[model samples]
Target chain A: MAQEERRILVAVDEGEESLHALSWCLENLVLQNSKDTLILLYVKPPRVVYSTFDGTGYLFSSDITAAMERYGQEVADVVLEKAKKLCNNIEKVINMVENGDPRDVICEMVQKLGADVLVMGSHGYGLIKRAFLGSVSNHCAQNAKCPVLIVKKPKPANGNQ
Target chain B: MAQEERRILVAVDEGEESLHALSWCLENLVLQNSKDTLILLYVKPPRVVYSTFDGTGYLFSSDITAAMERYGQEVADVVLEKAKKLCNNIEKVINMVENGDPRDVICEMVQKLGADVLVMGSHGYGLIKRAFLGSVSNHCAQNAKCPVLIVKKPKPANGNQ
Candidate 1:
């Protein structure tokens, strides 16, 4: 039987863990097949803090929001640039950035794109920390229709693949 | 440098999800290099009924404990046997079984073994179900020192990899 094309959606963030997962995907998940596509998804979280000026309570400023948006864009570009350098075939890569909660945005995009596999990196958060902060990869694993692959970067001693 | 011998630990259980992960490891993680090793870990939950029985009027029976142990062993063998068949090179595979909470046991074993990467299969349980029952893979991802890989089986339309 002919090999069907595969869509591998990788969740990208500013952390090293996400970059490790992206590298691993490039090395292992990106098939030699021409049809295979690697999607780099970077979800920019909604703003959490608003500037209050002149004793005004909870007033949002357009300037601050614009700056935040610019920061998000810079982050997306840096990570995507790093990912592209790691890939042998950069043309097969698709970069996507969206503003929302990462947990929901990732699941939604995976379904919308009909992704075959959702690749993620373990943030290396301790149990207690994860319990408090929650984990986007963990959430996607439970909710995404397709299978989720969470990749951890090898320890320093182990050396990279 | 010659490919350093790599230890890829896979968590196994009596579920299709685990077997799917084992298959995925064989096809993707297990390179042609003879130095690569695959470790299959099966964590059997501690007997919950025994503690309940001891508290209640009903006395714990040795017979029941023996039966439970036997069942656990049977499950371990079945999953490992299935995993072994999936591998092209069986000599590099190792099978281990432990009795404890799966979430704790899996993380402990991954560290104790100094595994390079820990591979697991997501149970495909929904968010609500996972919140009630808890998830082992999610726990391991958060706590394990090494990298964790959770493989999800492809959807029917996409066809299996």
Candidate 2:
């Protein structure tokens, strides 16, 4: 059988760490060949809980929800655009946007797409804070169907945080 | 200036998850080229509280501690040997054994060695359990100077754990 193209799914957000991951993937994982496809995924948490009553105490939930959805889509487009610009071979690029919890959406998409690997960026939360706030990348690492790369931005050499 | 070889550090243990990570690295990350070097690291937690009372009610802490140290070294050797055998190019492999908390040791070594990437295997702990047990891979992902890849073993097809 002829070899299939490698599918690399990268989870990107507005964070600098996510951008670093995309850059690292381009420099290290993405080969200069036609047999690789890089999928840029942006997961927006569903805005169903944002519904609230307006000034008159009447429900304006639908209008607010629609606006939130549009905002989410805009964020996805901007992040994907920046990721595409960083790629040396934009021909292999594909974009995906989904509305759900990122921890769940990422793992689900990896299996649904049959991706060879899933890449993400660490939010750089310390142990105590991560323990309390919960880390999406850490959750995905444990639950994802394929291999996960959680890229961390390099620390400055001066030993400053 | 010519590009320096990329240093890839992989954390291994007796668990199948880690060995799965090593296999995935060889298949996906390591290319048939001379510009990449793989470092296999096994961190043993320091045996500080091995206090023991021997026969005749005498303390045999020193002897027991020595024995434990030896056992730790033996385990390291076995794991490294198995990892080396998995690689097609053993010439580019290096083994490092350190004694400290795995989370602290892994992150420290990544910066000290100037590794381009650090790879590890997820233990598949869920959020509640991981929150208490404290996952090393998750901690390293947050703190490491370089990119971190936490490889998860593929789940069974039947959707059973």
Candidate 3:
């Protein structure tokens, strides 16, 4: 029987770990002459909600918020551009940008896009930091409907554990 | 450049979830005419240490311990047999049985065997049970040297969350 085409969704970010994961997926998962759809998803953080008064009791201006949103878009564009270069040989590649908490957005997109597999990068955070700031890969692995592959960037041989 | 062959390690057990994961890997990850190696690993729980005196002060015999050990081995054989049947089309396949805490044994074997990717099933335990019992897949994903793929069995259409 002929194999069905798969939709592989890869979560990309500004971090080197994410880019490394993208390269690994391209090398290992994407097969030659296969009609697989590679979806590159970059999620921007949700817009910061600011009250009229700042924490220091100073009035918050709309211009600062607009600038921040613009910066977020620019960062997304840069990351997507870098990711696109790595997929030049792929026949079908899609780039997407969404705004929300990455942990939630990634799982939602995987279902929304009917992804066959979800590839992500592990931040390799220590216990303390992971407890304080939750790990996105961990959350998605537990929540995503499809198979989730968490790619860890190998540590330096000379580095400490 | 020619793509390098990869060693893919899969963890299996008596659970239906694991068998489903094996089928998923065979369908999605394993390629035809590729020289990839598929390692099927089944981890038997460590032997239960029995004291001379039982909980009710009854004398415990060596025969009981021996029977338990035999049962563990039999279960491993059964699971490996079932998993092997799914990989009949694959060119290279290896079956392994180890006795220890699965979370530790799996991570150690992934490094020891030089596996490129580790595939396992997600039990999908609830927050309360997962917190108390700990998740082997979660631990391996966090600690393993190579990438970890946690394949979640899709719930029934009418199943509760």
Estimate the TM-score of every prediction. Answer: 0.78, 0.81, 0.86
Name the candidate that leads on lDDT. 3
Question: Model 2 in CAPRI terms: which quality?
Answer: acceptable
Error of 2 at B141 (Å): 1.2
The digit string of per-residue lDDT tens for model 2 on A3-118 reads: 35789999888776788888888777776654778999887765533332133555656767688778778878998889888875646888888877677888899989988888
Q: What's the ranking of the predictions by lDDT, best on top?
A: 3, 2, 1
**Model 1 interface Cα RMSD in Å:** 4.6
| Residue pairs in collision within model 1 | A147-B152, A152-B147
Q: Write the per-residue lDDT of candidate 2 for residues B77-149, one digit (tens) a residue.
A: 9888887888756458888888776778888999899898888888622223233347877788778888788
| Residues A26-137, model 3: lDDT tens digits | 8887775788899999987655322222457555577977877787799899999999999999999999999877888989999999998999888722222234447988
How far residue A14's Cα lies from its native spot in candidate 1, in Å, is: 2.1
Cα RMSD, model 3: 4.6
Q: What is the TM-score of chain A in candidate 2?
A: 0.79
Name the 10 consecutive residues with the lowest summed lDDT in model 1 chain B. Answer: B124-133
The residue ranges of model 3 lying beyond 4 angstroms of the native Cα positions read A49-60, A124-133, A158-161, B48-60, B124-133, B158-161
**All candidates in order of DockQ, best leading:** 3, 2, 1
Model 1: per-residue Cα lDDT over B52-141, one tens digit each = 435666655888788877876887788778877777564688888888777888889888998877888886222332344488777887
